[model samples]
Target: MNLNATLFAQLVVFFILAWFTMKFVWPPIMKALDERATKIAEGLAAAERGRQSLDLASKHSAETLREGKEKVAEVIAQAEKRALQIIEDAKLQAKSEADKVVAGAKAEIEQEAARVKESLRERVAELAVAGAEKILRREVDVKAHADMLAAIKQDL
Candidate 1:
């Protein structure tokens, strides 16, 4: 290649323009680009932290829901147990009352039977005395009969 005047002048102009660009435009442009890069890195780190926080929160919420379900089941079981206990107690109380009533009825029946036996015995005795008097055919004195009746009653 021939070293020419035009080439030499073109090289000079090119170097001057490059020097001007590096001094004025390149510094500010590189600073802005670096700032943008830093912002992007910070935004990525923040996004990662936010995702981790969300994951942790979701796990905590799931655990809380499980615990709540367990508590509800426990409460239901306790309620069922309590209800059964109450029912059993009521049944026991009713059985006790029924037994008491039966006992009272038995006692009353025994008393009534005793009274009826006593009345039957007295009636039988009166009938026997009347039959004996009819067979004898003698008129018994009322005062003597009353005294004999009182003596027989005392002996019985």
Candidate 2:
């Protein structure tokens, strides 16, 4: 064989093989690489979306907890105000009851004083009659001297 002819033939065959590989085998391999790249991009996008959703959820949870704390503080403040109101009402009621008891006690003292004054007057009249009988040293007819005795009792 001639070396120049053999080298030329080998160059032709190499070009044909390269063209066939580019047309058939290389296209499928490139298509598979593009599909894999697209799938990886989509997966990365999905992961980023999940991270954003988690951040949003955490923010919402914090907001809800703050609102609950505010509600609890408001409730506690209202309860304190109500407790103060109840205490004031109880004090007022107790004062009113004390005033009523004092008034009743004063009324009872006045009634007892009136009864004592009437009894003292009756005792004074009896003592005057006994002293008169002792001075005369005789039994005085109380019925006959009733008018004079009544006048003496009135003077006393």
Candidate 3:
């Protein structure tokens, strides 16, 4: 075979194969590659969005937890304040009750003292009349001595 003609024939066959591959096989292959690239870019974008959403959710959860802690603290403080108020009220109520008991005891004592004084006056008047009757060596007339007994009772 002639070398130049063989070289030329190989060149023509190479051009036909290149044209057939470009028209039929290469186009589908390129399309597949382009679709794959687009799918990869979309997947990366979705991953980034998921990461951002996760971060946002974490921040919101942390904020909610902080708010809950603050509310719990506030409630505890309020409960403490209420407990203190209740204790103070109890103290004041107890003191008032004690004062009322003391006042009632003092009133009862005054009433008892007044009754004893009246009984003593009657006894002293009877004793004075009896002594007079003994000194005179006779029984003193009861109705006659009524006015004198009253005067002696008043003096006592």
Candidate 4:
């Protein structure tokens, strides 16, 4: 084998080409890969934060719904209580009015009975006087006769 100038020049040229590729191409490639990795990591972190926020919002919405339901129930309960009270009050008033009406009716009936009794007594006395005057017909002293007739009526 012969040692040759052409082979030695070929070796030198390969070394220079390798050095140029490492300095110019490799650094930019590594920097681009690192930047891509950082961007991916930031995107994943942002997605995680968004999911946590959504979960918190859902929980808050559920709590608010429960509170609203409880408030509605409370209002309904109050309304029922008020209705019962109003009904009870109305019943009491009606009973009181009915009692007053009954008492008034009883008083009116008593008054009517007393008037009828007085009228009957007056009619009986008038009839007695007329009968005595018819039977006696001027045969007796008027004053004594009147007294006797009154006494007889009292006995009857």
- Model 2: per-residue lDDT, tens digit, 48-152? 999999999999999999999999999999999999999999999999999999889988888888778667766788887777767754667778788998997
Model 1 stretches with alpha carbons more than 4 Å out: 1-29, 112-138, 150-156
User: How far off is residue 90 in model 4, in Å?
Assistant: 1.3
Q: Which ten residues in a row have the lowest lDDT in candidate 2?
A: 133-142
User: At residue 149, what lDDT does model 1 achieve?
Assistant: 62
Give the least accurate 10-residue stretch of model 1, judged by summed lDDT: 147-156
| Residue pairs with clashing backbones, model 3 | none
List TM-scores for all candidates, in order: 0.60, 0.60, 0.67, 0.56
lDDT of each: 0.88, 0.89, 0.89, 0.88
RMSD of 1: 4.7
lDDT of 4 by residue, 14-34 (tens): 999999999999999999999
Q: Which candidate leads the pack in TM-score?
A: 3
Ranking by lDDT: 2, 3, 1, 4
The true-versus-predicted C-alpha distance at residue 128 of model 2, in Å, is: 4.4
What is the lDDT, from 0 to 100, of the residue 136 in candidate 2? 56
Clashes of each: 0, 0, 0, 0
